[model samples]
Each structure stands twice: as C-alpha cells, then as structure tokens.
Target: EAEAVLGRVEDVAGLFAETPERSADSPGSDWEDRLRDLAVRAVLGEPEQAAMLARASARELQATLGVDALRVMSGSISYVRRFWAHNLKGAPKASLEAWFEALTEYAVALSYSRRLCTRSVACAVQRERPGSEGRRLAADLAQRGDEESVDYGATCTDAYVAGDRVRSLVNMAGLPNWALHEGDEGAVEAPGPLHGCASICFNKGTVVLPLTDICRPRDFEERMCGRGKPCRGFAPGQLVRSLVSAACHPRALARGLEGRITAVDRTRGRVNVDFGGTNDNGTEGALRVTLLLSDVSPVEEFEAKLQSRREALGGFFVGESVRSLIFLPLQASRPLLFGAEGVVSMLDLQHRRVLVRFGGEEPLQVLLRFQDVCLMDEFEARLQERRGVLAGPLPG
Candidate 1:
C-alpha cells in the first residue's frame, strides 16, 4: 500500500491533488525512472538512514538523500559479486545457478552490516536528528530491475537469449563457464560471454527453473549436495527477537526480547530460547523457554523506530531524564541495566543501544532501548508493585 503514495512528497501542498478515484498503476511518470536496487539497499542502511528505511522507495528520498549518501553503491556491487562466487563454488549449478545467485544476493541485500545492507532512506531529513526523533517521509521507490524477477520470475530465455547481443552483463544468468571471471576488464563484449550457453536450446527444449519448483535431483536441503545444511533457518546459538507481542500475547511471550536459541526441536515444531530470566526456583528467566518456530525472527539489522519507543514518554529527546528497567537476571558476568536514573544522551547506533549518561561521575551506560529503560513518571509504583520486574531481585 505504501507504493500507492509514490509521488506524495512533491504533492506536499496537495493543492492540485487528484481525487480518491485515481488508479495506483498509472500514478506518475516518475515511476519510469529507476535506481540500482543493489546500491539503494547497501549504503542506505547507515544509522539514521537505516532506521528511516522505507521498503517502498519514495522519491522524496531522492530529493533529501544526497549523492554522498549513495556513493558506496558503486563499490558495493563488488561485495555482492564476491559473495556470489564464494557461495556458488561446488554447487551442482547445472540449470538453477541463476536462482542460487539470486538467493545469495537477496540474503546479502538484507545483511545487518551497515556497509552492505540494502535498506533505503525513508524520508528526506538531516543525517541525524539532533533533539529528538520525529516523523519521516515514506514513498514507493522504483521496482528493482531483475531483482524481483530473479527470485520468482526468470525463464530460460531470461538468461541465454541466443543471438541476443546484450550490452550489460549485470543480471544476465549466463552459465558457470560464461560467468564473469577474475581479472576481467573493459566494456563486456556480447557473444563472448554467451559462449556455449546458447547451445543449451537444442537439448530437447530444456527450461531452467527454481529448485523448489523442480521435483527431483534430490530436494535442496540438509547438506544439500553436501552444501551447508540449513537448520530450519534459525541456527543454534544465534540471537533472535520474539515475534510475539507482550500486550497481545501476555501468556505466550514478550516482544522485542533478544534471546539466544539453545536448541531447535523440528520434530515438535518448537525452539528453546534462553532469556536468562528464571524464578528463584527456575522459570522464564532461568530455563530455556520453548516457543513455536514461527514466533521469532532474526535481528540482522537492529534498530527501532518512533513506534518502537514508549508512547507515554511523548518523545525520547536527548538529555531527557530516565531510569533503568527493573533488574532482570542475566548470564553470569553479564552487565545488568537495572539500577539508578540517568539522562538520555544519544543513540549509539553502532551497538544498537541507547547511551544513557547516568548520574555521578560514572560513564554512559548503553542499554537495550526496548527492555532496559523507561520514562521517570511511574518508576516508583512499577518498582513498588513489582509489575515491571523483567529480571532479578536486584543484587544488593
């Protein structure tokens, strides 16, 4: 639905706005313009930009995001190319090489690394919000070329179009031998890269498709052709955020909690998440909590938006006073964010934590924005009633 508002930014005054009857498909001529989906997703994940990411790439971002913000895109193509070579090594790669290459690219596109991620700016705002966070613009960006098609689309002809001398070699799914090799240079020659790829047409009209679509050749999973086995996606010991909402599913689990996966029980469709918050005798904080496989997602890019903060606080402004969350039990030798009041200093985007300058000569303590602190209003009652006690009894 965000795409519907593709050209809203220029319509800021809305003086000449169209009525509600306009069709989304023909919204604007700007839809014809495009940007590299690769570069757009790469450098766009930088701190302020990452949090402001709008999946529907809006044009307002174009006006606001300076050329400097997008400079890394040209170089980041190298990273994507590198990941492809390393990932495709030793694969059966017969006909489905195109699809496999797409997967690695999609995975890298969403990589948590700020340098390599693919999220794009949500609005045209300053690089960093000084006083407090605020609303941002969101609009539909161009549908990336071949990116969408590479994953789900793409026919045999999509790759080896015989006699079709194409200039660019970017997204073409040429065969392994035809793949761009090391030390290659200059503007790519057409048929030179096509090579033997064009001859596949005579092999009884063979067609290329995704492994999931194909039924045979040994289903792609669990040491897939001796390739790395996928542990149902979530690997043991990887950090995951609960998809459940505490308010909506109080009895089930809490949202925004980062827990490590201890074990995955595929037979029962369950996974054990270790939150380290156990009762004195052992419970939610102690023993591993079992969750349905669907209740959690990975935090490759960890940062929160205005919605992720406490609505009661009005706004999380810099220098705003704050207090730590109720002490929760933690792994031995791990630091606890549960003591004393502090002032909200700045957002430490690198660590994905809030740098709170606590009182006294002590240094700033970076606490998890979701679980470790709150506004000063009801601090006393929550502490007295023991309502928000997420962790321990507070070690004296």
Candidate 2:
C-alpha cells in the first residue's frame, strides 16, 4: 500500500513519527488504518472537495460577470479536474457576442463526445488584454502566490468533455494525474508528480451558472434570415439620429447630432457622421465614434409618422399578411432551436406567441421579441454575407 500510495520507501517515514523507539507494528492494524485514511484524505478526498468548492466559485463568477460563460477548473491534491460557469456582465457587445458563441460551441463538442466528467472543454472567445474598464477586475492567480486560495487558479489537469446524463449536455473537462492507477477500493498514486493540480483563474465580474446551462440549443438554423436587428450599414448619404445622451457624443453635437452617416462598419461597431462639412459652432470636423445597435435609435418623427400612416391604412401589425416572414428573438445566454425565421400564418399581438409556419409545416406557436420581428423585404441581401462574419461561424 505504501509503494502504491506514497510512491517510495524513503517517503514512508514522512507519514509517521521519526522517533527511534517507535516500531512499525507497535500501533498494529488500527494505527495503519488511520494512516491510510490520512493518505486518502490528502490524495483524493481533499481534491474532490476542492472541485466542489471550485464549482461553487464558478457559479459566483458567472453571476458577477454576466458573460455567456466563464469556466474555472482546479485540481485535486495531485489530480486536477473541475469546472464552473458565469456570465460576462457589461462587456463590450462584440466581445460578449463572440464569447457567447464560442462558449456554445465548446458545450456542443462536449455533448458529441458522449462522455461525462467534470473536465473542461475550451471554446476560446479570443483572449484579450482587458480594456481600461476590464483591467480593474483582472487578476492572475500565479502572481498572487497566496496559500488560502492555492487551488484558485491551478491548472493540473487537461481540459476534456463531460455532461449530465439526463440532458446529454457536455460542459467541463479537466486534467488528472497521468500516473494515477485505479485500485479496487479507490485511486492510487503510481509514479508521477508528488503534488499539484490544474488551475485556472480569472479576474472579472460574472454570475455563476451550471456548466450545462451554457450548451447551445439542439438544431438551430444554420442560415439566419436577413431579419432581426438592423445591423445593415448606413449609406454614405443616409441620415441617422443619435440615441445617446449629449455627454456620450462628440462635443460639437451637444444639441444632438442628426447628420448623414458618411461611413459605417457594422462589424466594427463604428460610424462616422458628416454634419455636412461644417456646423454652426464649426466644432465638428467629423465625428468618428463607436456605435452599437443600442446607440442608434429610430428617428421618432419618422417612426411615429410611419406608424400613423400604417394605422390609417387599416392596421400596423407586422406579419399580418399571408407568407410574411417572422423571427424569434435570441435570449440572454440561452439558445433556442426555432428562434430564427418562420412564415407568419397568423398574427395576434394580444397573444404571447405568434403563429408561424416553417417550410411547409403546420403553424406553430412561437414567441418573438418585438425587436427581432422585422419585415423580410426589409432585410438586405448584402447584409446576409456579413452575418457569418459578425456572428462568427456556427457552433460545432
């Protein structure tokens, strides 16, 4: 047992007193049992317990960050296998979306493996140097060298795939001591590292969630309808209204900048506004700034006028006509199978879900986020080419 557990004869002394009068058999089998228990606690029990704690920590991290997923893994005394999840909160929209997709792909791969263990499967969202806002929360466990949180960011195990039996969802994978040998009773250390486990630590605010919660919904549409949020770029001569407060925009347009969008890159989330060569204060040569779907609201005058005209024309309901295309809105962190596009068979805003048909199928009740519901004719064909670039490739 000592050869299997302690690894070497010389190390056996480390488990008991060094006093010369002590006999190895003096304490009998009872004493040996106690020592064996100590070895098990130090070798296996402690690490499993740490993994349980790491799971809790991962949960806390998710709630605080609000990202789609944030997983952490820590090793046992010598074996490392653990994982947890969290959300990335208040992150840049592009990063948030990218990470969310990557995390989903990671989850899918795990499910495909058909194996379940608390291992980590990585789907990188791109490692970035935290922006000024993100740096404040950044921490590298290696730099701290603290004892209480010894396993906080240790990486002793290889990342792999595991899942819940009922859900068939894969979420985490971690490395274990390569030299571990399973015995009839439990695992026994063979010849390998004396101590150390896998460690991963992050410094970010996130909320904790179960790793399985991050998996993508089964069979989402591979092709997205040109519908959904207005991600199409504005023409150079097109006019747009600013949706942000004056403080957030360039100083020259304090009264609110309503100008032609000279340049726009929907992928980069940037826009250049030409206030027509010069302004009254001449304070604006041009305003090139970051813009998001939320930073640009519809022109109220145009929206209100359009609504009135539609209402006067009998009704203002979208998908009211036969063969109208409708879409379901993406949820926060949770992916849905049929949220992309469907043909409108019936329209009733009064009802919670709309009745829509998909590809010659019977009408199905589907919920649509008001924002996600858009007229199909309104979708730009050119924008479809850019969809893959913006949303990233489909999850595996």
Candidate 3:
C-alpha cells in the first residue's frame, strides 16, 4: 500500500513540475487539464483520486530527499529571505531591487537538495585566478611586508593577483608549508618582525560574504562610541535639516562656511558637521571643522527641534527626562561599515546622548560630550520642555 502511494505522489509531482513547460508551449493549458488527465488514468476516481495523488507525492518526497535534506533546503530558503531583508534595510531602493532578482536565482537553486553541485561549480570558478593560470604570480608582496594579501588569503582561502603579490585564491589553499621561502633565518630579528613567519592555512573552505554587508564590531563601536555609549535622541532627517540650517546661518555664511553633515546622534541630540575652509586661491579646500549642533543652533531652537525632529523621524524613541530622550526617526542613514561612505544618526534615550558617526573604510565611533557643546539660542529651552513630555512619568 505504501509503495503504491509513493508511486502516485511521484506521478503527480512530476506532472506538476512539467506544467510550467507545457503551459509555455500551449497557452491554453491549465491546472484542470492536468488534473483531469491524472483522474482518468487512476483506478480510484474523482476527489479520492486527487487526494491519493497528493498523499503519495508527500510520502515520496519524504522518502527520496529524507528529513535532513528537506530541512536544509527549507533553511536555505529562510536564510536567503533574511539575508536580503536585512540588506534591504540599508541599501538603496534601486540597488535592493536589482539584488532581489540576482538573489532569487541563488535562493531557488539553494531550495533544491542538489545545491552542493552548484556550490562545487562556484568553488571551481576560483581556478580562473592568476597563479592557477599558466604562470605562477611571484610573492613580491610578501617581501614588501604587505599584510592585506596575507589577510585576504587567510580570510577567503583563495586569492590571485598579478604583479607584486603572490596572490591566488586557488594554489594558496593547498601549497605545502615547508615550500615557502624563509627569509631572515638566523639573522637578528627586526623590532616588529616575528621570529617565525605565520603560514596561511587553506584546509577549510572560506565563507565569502561582502565586507560591506557584514556588520563588524567596529560598526557597533562607531554607532555606539567607546564602552557602547549609545547616541541618544538624534534622527537622520533632523540632522540633515540641522546641517542645512547651520550652513545658512548668518555668521557661517559670512565666513563662506557651509556645514557638511557627517553624522547624527538622535539619542544625545548632537550633529557632527564639517566646516569647509578657504584655500590659498580663496576657493574652498577640504572641510576642517566639526561643529557640534549645540554650537550652531540657537539654544531654544536646538532643544525644540530635538522633540519636533523626534516626532518627524520615528523609528525607535527612548528618553529619561521628557526633555532628553533620543527620538529615532523613520528614515535612517546607513550604518558605518567597510566601503560604506555616508552619514549615520545614533540615538540613546537612556543617556540622552546622540552620536554622529563617520569615516574610515572600517567604522569608528567618536563621542561628543554635552559639556563640549556650546549652546546657541533660546530654542534650546523650549526643546527641553518637549523632551520633558517624552521622558515624563506616564499617567495611571
């Protein structure tokens, strides 16, 4: 009975799998046509026949793929969804849409138990790199003391580069350790040089993920600052507005100083602004000054804007006193990460601190102390009142 059921299920699954191709050939082909064909062939007819077909398919799938295969395929589907979803949060809409299509093919292939075949093909593609080619690329980078090539080989287990570096993702993984050249052997070790060189290990396959996509420890540090001090009460949109206003301020305009926003801290109500400086020719050179928001805004405006901005921004809002919680707005700048160039706004309601994050291929967080802020106007006082409401005790 079980064998019979398995046969029935396999028949239905096979038919369903072919439906797409059939429909493409004959536009009029429909699900009913497929079902009717199955029904006519079965000894058991109508509803019973359809039901039997489904049950058999399920049983056969379980038998052929096994529970572990099914589980892995299902998990891969979920992982693909989660990976893209997380990426969509920070990526531009157009880029996200493009990646969505690219990942769909990867996700669909991963859904099959046959994904190992696909992975094998991808791994084989590494053979196209330099050293794996006709001529072996010399390891000149090793002599130059370049750590990047070494780290790349360690991280990816495969790399290939022409010119100065002996980089190739393929041969590096399996090269014999003793075959490596030993320089400075028995010579006096230089100050920073180690006694024994660290050889690259290629036993395990490297899991290559885009560095920009992975959130590193440094990103958390840049967003939170040292000791994980959260940037409180700042939102990205508000910070943008603040920079625009500050750049337009009379004194700033008089000096031809336009503020370029680098980071926003919603939690602490701070903005990191870059003040453009004049060059020898009287044209603007690179920006040199970082003005805290407190130094630019009228005290009252700065305080008032924080609450108003919090309401406008709207992602996550937190505060201690109604006057000082970080109001996270809906729109957020991308977080600091390798190869990521843009601004980020951080808010920490608990400490009522906000940090504006900026710079480096690797992210770095710098805290702006409230004491460091030079208040500008009466607007600060009014902002304090609104913040009071956000942070105040709730009604019973």
Candidate 4:
C-alpha cells in the first residue's frame, strides 16, 4: 500500500483511517462493515478486503463525482506508471476527490491481475447492450477446467445494475457533485473542481435532486398536460413562465413568475429554476427553489422570436471580460480559478458557445456554453461565497 502512494497521497492503508471505524461485533450492513472488514484484512495481510473496500470507495466516488471520475482516476494512475514520472509536487493532498481517487489507484493496482474492477464497466455494458450483454466477457475470462462455461463475472458485475443503483446513474445528467448529493451530504456540499463534475450556469443557482426524482426533458410530459399545467420539459437555460397558481406554488403568483430553466429533474418530473423577486419579506437574497415541471410554461413564442433576434445579433460583441461561474462559482481561493476572471475571445453562434480566455501564469482558452459564465456587471451579484479554503487565487 505504501508502494502505491503517489507523492502526497495518503497511504491507502492510512487513509482508510479517515473513514468511520466499524465496530467489531456489529458487522452492520452499512458502510461501517466494509470499513471494518478492510481493517481486519489488512492486519491479516490479505489484500482482498482492501480491494473490496477500494471498490466501494470507487463507487461512492463515482456516486459523488460522476462516471467521468473513472477516466481521471485511471489517467492519473497511468501517468505515474509511465517512464518519465514527475516528483508530483504539484499534486495537492487535501481535497476529498483526490483522496478518493488515490484509493481507486490502489484498487486498480491490486486488482490488475485479479480484475476486481470490472463491476462498473460490466454493468455499464450490460445496460447499454442488454440484448447481447456479457458475450465478450464470458469468452475472455473463460476457465479451461470448468464443466460448462460459467458466467461468474457477470453475476457480480450485474448485481448493481438490476436496481435503481445510484452508482450506475452517477452524473448521467451532467449535474455537479452538490447536485448529485441533492445538497444533502455535507461532505460534498460544494462543487470542488471541474474535472469529472462539470457545471451548469450555477449562476442561476440549482436544486439538487435524486435520480429517481427527475425525468429526462424529452420524456413525455406527465403532470402538465393532465391539468393544463405547463407540461413538456424545456431545454436547460431556455426561458419559461409559470402556469401555476399561488396555491400550487406560493412564490409562483398565479402564472406570474418567469425564469430560465437551470436544470430539469426529469426522473420525478420537476424542475430547478434560477428566478428571483419572489421573496416578500426580503430578509435575505433568494436562493434556488423547486417547482413542479407542469407548473411552468416556456416563455412566449414572442420571447422565442426575441431570442432569435438576439441570436441574429449572436450574443457577443468581440471582447468582454466575464467571470466564470463554475467550479467554485463566485470565487475559489484553493482551486486557483473559481470565479476567476476571463475575457471572451470568440463566439460560436451555431452552438451558442463562447470561447473565453482565462489569464494566468500560463494563459488558457476554454470554449463553454453561453450560460456557464456571468457578465462582469452581474458577476458580483451572482457571485457565490468562496467555498473550501480562504486565500488568494495564487499559491505562495
């Protein structure tokens, strides 16, 4: 386990201590059992428990960060395995995502010969190709001495696939970790980085939800059509109007509220909006609020025409400096670029994306959807408080 630790990464054996310790006699079904088993196995000098614990950690990481975490975790491990590896002084040791990824790296190394990491991949394949699932895996891992070709791998790999497994559905909707936890798990309450977890125009604010609570925007409109409610989900960022009465939604003043769709919880047929001015008491700034999907109608076709006219103008005028509202949103002290300043370099009216050039010691240009950034004047207003550590954008 020490051999697997990279640079500042905590030793996999040592990092396991960060997780809650499990009771010896309890053997609970929850995450505690897995932690205890890992501890006992390490003392016995068997790596199998370590592998399983790492697997669980991997899945939980996936649950928090999304499926693309696999790529980042795998690539980080691969980069170290290469011939010209760095001393990796640049790798920060404190972030939660980095720590979980380290555990995954340890798992990947230990499971290389054992192939214990196939559970997620096999499940994804089975889901994508249920008609002919496991035909390849069966042949690849076939044992010569078996009486019949056994599908042992598929049994374990596909177990999580049969239910509403959160692992399999991690970030399928492109929501950040905070949204994945639905703002419940304080551990990942803020969006840490933009690697596996990308951002919507978090400037609009968001309502995190469960995979079961939302539906795909393109799926059939359920509650809306049934009651003359604004059914039929609109694309993210499109303008919408309220069709609901104050009784159904208090802030929605009987078909008065209007805002753009920041996100759609298509699973349970709801939406998370980024509108304001609903606060009557005006004690504090309004935050993201949830409303029934059927309760809001898309903005008028006249507004759509206005959008086309704006599109005719194409949404940019050469160069403008706007703050990116991703990663840490308003600002980030630790990650270097949260709420960082950038200048618009180009526009893609065809896709409505913009190219923003972020300035740093080494300049970087990124092409992002128009909504992911906020104009400078609006930046301070929408600017969320910096999450995580408090410091300047640059490292000392």
Candidate 5:
C-alpha cells in the first residue's frame, strides 16, 4: 500500500515538475526538506523524529515503518553519555499490539501527507496551462485595453481584471477567496460596483450572479414544481433545481444541482454552464445545454409574495456530498445509469455541469450533467432553511 501511494505521489509530482514553467526552475531546493518534515510529522505526530528514522526519504521511511517490538525498540533510544554519548543499553519494551497501532497511525498520516503534496504540485502546474475558451475570450478582451468594460455575458464568473495577464486556474478546495486589489486602497470586496450584489471570486472564474435575479423570482416552468404549478425560471447565475425531462437524461440525486449558468442564448434557446471548482477534479469548462424553450414557456417575472421556506436559493455550495451513481443514457434501447458516490467537487454555473470524484486511494474524477443531479432528500430540509435565510421570510 505504501509503495502504491508513493508511486502515485511521484507520478503526480513528476507531471507537475515537468510543466514548462516549473521545468525552468528544476527541483525546488526545499521540496525534499518539506517532504521530510511532512513525513516526520506523519510518523511522530510531532516534529520530533525517532532515532532510527531521522531524515528518511519516502522510500526509506516506508521501509522503516513498523510497530513490531524489535522495530520499536530499534527506533526508540535515549542517549547515555558514559562513553562519548553511546546509545542506550536496551530499547524501551512495548506490546506488539501497541506497536502495531502506532505504526498504523503513522502509515495513515504518511498517506495523507503524500496526497497533500501531490495535490499541491498539481494545482501549481495547472495554473500555467491554458484556460477555457470563454476564459481565453475574456482574457483577450481584457488585453485589448480599449474597452472600458467587457461583458462576459450572464451567469458566468472569472471576471476580467484590468491589467493582469491571463493565468490558468487549478482545482483545489479551501483556497482563500480571490480578491481584486486596487492600488493602495486595499482589497476590493465582492460585487464591487461592477455589479450591484454579493459575489464570490475564484482563481479561474468570478461568480457574478446578479442580485436582481436573486431578489425577483421568475416563473420558469409550470410542470417542474408539480402539475399546474409553475416552477421558477433559473437566471444566468442560478442553479437548476430539477432536470429538464426533455433533455433525455434521467434525474440524478445530486448531479443536477452542480451547474451554474455562464451564458444564455435566447435566439438559439440554449444555455452554457460550467461545473466543478470544489475538489481535486479541477475546473472543467462550461458545456452548452439546450433549453426546451419551445415546449416550456420562457421565464416570466412574478410578483414577490411573502412565504416561509418555499423560496429558492440561487446556487449551491461547492464540495457538497452526493451519491455515487448517476443516470446517463448510453444507448437508445436502454438508458445507462452509472455513477460512483462522490462529492460535488466543482460547480461551473456558466456551462452547466458538475464534477464528482469517487472516494478511493487513487483520485478519479467524472463529469455529469448539471440538470440530472438533485439534492438528496436528507438535505431538502437544510436547503429550505438556507433558502429561508437567503430569501428572508419567516417559515410558518
């Protein structure tokens, strides 16, 4: 298991190191040191190193890892300065079971550390690669230096920065919110004057969901909520609460909730959405999803009415939990529903889709249609509570 983990780590790290920008720098001078520090922490759960495992490489460390009586005794030693600081006469005795337990903890920590290292390197290299087509287009507009403001269309993030060169974005969870700085005035807060509302900025895309869309609900489809009851229309930045049955895709419990609209084509009756920004799956580009405008009536503005938890929340939190299987049809005769339980790793609103990663030793990422996935039943109550908070109405 340790060997397999080491191999995977090396493979990912090698790829990251070989990138054009990274290759110019060669092996980081402190990379090995950092790895050693991580290994020591994993093994000892502290900075202090055992006598036998001092300064060990991943391979060497793996070989030395074990909590057998002999191994523990060999690794644990106290100093005796009787004759030029000779080693202790005998190793501290411990039960095999205890040793084994300690060893297991170390191994788990080591594996975790390896994963962290691989992910860190991969993220650094990813940013150097080319961005999505829409991102490139936006970057181009920003480069032209003539337009006072560039419009990336509705339901999209990755806001244009005036002079910043186009840079690649990597998928990693828990990164500090991306902030735009303006001279000495300090960090520019979200939705700053650009659009009037709260927004979140990502290294790859900036979420600019319009505040108006959030405030005023649009009646989208009558059949979605239930028969004869019109469901709300999703705006450019809003999420698809349910699937469009006409799209020929089965409803997935969690996948449908992943997408965020990036662009909407009224003439063509199509919307572009992107998924995944929450986990190791990285930020995949937006996909063009066809909206059944002919069959389904267009979203119409509705009068605001005070209600309890029935109101909709415009979007979902990235990295939300989801079931493994999804409903995707592979053939006309039979629909293929395949999926492995995973988390909503990323959410691209512009080109609607969600990225999911199955839990395992090896990292695996898959993309599913945004509309097909739905929030799990267990989460419905929580979703309603969040909606109540965002929509600002008391529940009955």
Candidate 6:
C-alpha cells in the first residue's frame, strides 16, 4: 500500500509537468475534467497513469502560467474533501483509505504552494508594472469584505497579513477626509444653520414635497389632539403637536424619524427633520437632520451615486469627514422614507444600489428609482421653474 501510494504521488507529479501545453489549448478550462480523467485511470487500476496526469496539470499551471499550483491546491482542500466524501462509501476500504490519505497530503502541499504563489504575486505586482491592474483588482477584492471592518483594520489597528497589508496602507493613507477642518468655527456651532432638506425625483421623473401648512401654535396643538385632521387652517399648537407625534412615535423613531418636519425647502423638495431629540450618543439633544425621500422607489440608486462619489473622492480613509444632505419626495399619501448624508461605502451600479456607512459604523442601504434623484440637474431645473411660477412678482 505504501509503495503504491508513493508511485501514485510520483506519477501525479509527472503529469503536472506536461499540463501547461494541454491547458493552453483550452483556455479557462476548469480542473474538473483533469480530475475526472485521473479518476478514470485510477478506477481502471492504472495508478501510475492517474499520477502522471496530476503531475502534468500542476507543472503546466506553474511553469507556463506563472501560477503556483500548490497554493491553488491548498485553497481547494475543502473541495477535494467533499469529492472524497461523495465517492468514499462504495469504494474498496484499504485502497480508498490510501487514496484519501494521499489526497490529504496533496491538499497540504497545495496550500503551502498557494501561500508562496500569493507572496510572489504580491511582489511582482508591487514593482509598479506598467499597466498593472493589480491595485484595482486588490481594491475590488477588498470591497467584498465589510467596509467598516476593513477601515478599522487599516486605520485603527496595525494588523498585517499578506493580502490585506498593502490595501490597508492604501486605504489608510490615500482617502483622508480633509474637507472637514478641525477648529473650524462651523464645527463648534450649536446646531449649524440647518443645511438643507431632502428631496427625491421619482423614476417616472416627478419631484414632490410634503404640503407645508404654517399655523399658529394653538392650532397646531388642536390638530394633534384629533379635534382637527391635517387640513389647512389648524391652529399653530395643533400643527406643532401633530408634527411632534409624527416625529416622536416609537415606531417612527425606529424607522428613523417618525413625525416632524423641522425645516422645509420648497425648491429642493426636502425637509430638515428632528427625530424626537434622540442623538447618536443616546443623549437628549435634538437629532437635527436632513433626509431625502423618493416617491415609492427603491432607495438604491441614490446609494450608488453616493458610493461612487465616495470612491472617486477618496473618502474612505481614516479621519476623512463628510457632510450630510437629505432629500425627500412625497406622493399624495404614503409613509415617508429615509435618505442620507455622509460617506458612502458600497454601490452596485448594475443594480443601481448604494450603502453609506455613517458615524463610522452604522450602514444604511437604499434602492431608488432613476427619477428620484434630488440633486439631479434635470429635476432641480423643474423645481426652479415651479418656484418661479409661485413667486410671480406679486402680479404687480
């Protein structure tokens, strides 16, 4: 059994030497075909032939393609184990066991080979090869993991690994948010002039804002007590109470800001809101905010725009600060949705999706329709036209 295993190993090694030319003829072919061929030979009691095929495959991958076959093998251990499990039950016990042991050894060797390959690739890619796409590829792969985690690792912690170290350095040093200047007067102000409201341009290309009814303080209170509905002419008190109720309901708070319109921008179709004074630090300060709304469209499109901007702006590095802008669009009657401001971290443009990581941790993703962009120049133009009509020089 020992001699048989040794012979099989040697045969596999030899097969690897000749694989390059064979593989070149069928570019991007998977290894399963070669595995199956080896299996057939082995089942026919031609262990040497099976080994030879394996050897050639490994050799071709390494020599011709500059790939480390062993490293590739290591990453594939789980797959090999699965294959073994699938075929184990019906095989001759002793022979099957010996083959399994040999496969395990192969897996270990492959893993070590992969590690070396990964190191080699890292070095080669770093010499700043002309037209080297390594940096882009690395960035793409890094994004597959959690952005916050990657950000933290690359910035807060100094942990280094083969694949993550360079990316960590790039991300940490390249994307600092210099837009936010420390000791700036605006940074220390109590509730800076409410910047802007949120608005949405819908997929079908409509922009809408909640109806604004300014009333006396008493009228606002009556409306809230249900003595009056949300029609015009509620006393200011009724309006205020109703707004407070909408802004402060526990469920609304959970959905992010239930019932209040803190400020309004008719031209932008946006609202500056206070979500019942619950602050991020869990203190009782007003949650001064702006949020964008889309008319029943998925919030993803806006998210994509935000993520794309973040990447382009190099906004992901540590200490990089971003500002918030909210947009909201209203239909005749429906629940208002949330919008965003700050650093966008992920986007799926094909799907028109986006996710923003706010306050360094919380991530919000929204899907949006094409028409629901508040800042889109097309929509803004329409808004300006409407405003001009409403303000028409007081009919002199």
Name the regions of candidate 3 deviating beyond 4 angstroms: 1-13, 17-76, 79-108, 111-274, 277-303, 306-396
Query: Over the stretch 236-339, how does candidate 3's per-residue lDDT look in tens digits?
Result: 22332232222221122222223444445443344544443456753233332323444444333554655655454332222211111222222234333212
Q: Per-residue lDDT for 260-331 in model 1, tens only?
A: 775554544656566544456544323235566666677763344223443423345456687886453452
Better of 3 and 5 by TM-score: 3
> Which candidate would rank higher by TM-score, 1 or 4?
4
When 2 and 4 are scored with TM-score, the better candidate is: 4
List model 6 lDDT by residue over 6-89, tens digit each.
336455546655666354235565444554454434423343444455554554555653322433443354565567668777
> Which one is best on lDDT?
4
TM-score of each: 0.19, 0.20, 0.20, 0.24, 0.17, 0.25
> Which parts of model 2 are misplaced by more than 4 Å?
1-237, 248-252, 261-284, 291-396
Q: For candidate 4, lDDT tens digit of each residue in 1-396?
A: 343334232354466567675433333353334433543343334454445564664555455544333344444444543422244335565654564444443332322312233343333211222112222222322433321133221111211221221211122222332223122211112221332232222232343333233222322243222222333646567777655333222232334456666556554576665554446863233334456665666676444544454456454433557877666323232332557788878778889888888887666677777876767887766554332233344221
lDDT over C-alpha atoms for residue 89 of model 4: 35
Q: State the C-alpha lDDT per candidate.
A: 0.39, 0.32, 0.32, 0.43, 0.34, 0.33
Q: Which run of 10 residues does model 6 get worst, by summed lDDT?
A: 165-174
Q: Which run of 10 residues does model 1 get worst, by summed lDDT?
A: 164-173
Q: How high a TM-score does candidate 4 get?
A: 0.24
Winner on TM-score (1 vs 6) = 6
Alpha-carbon shift of residue 138 in model 2 (angstroms): 19
Candidate 3 residue 190 Cα shift, in angstroms, is 31
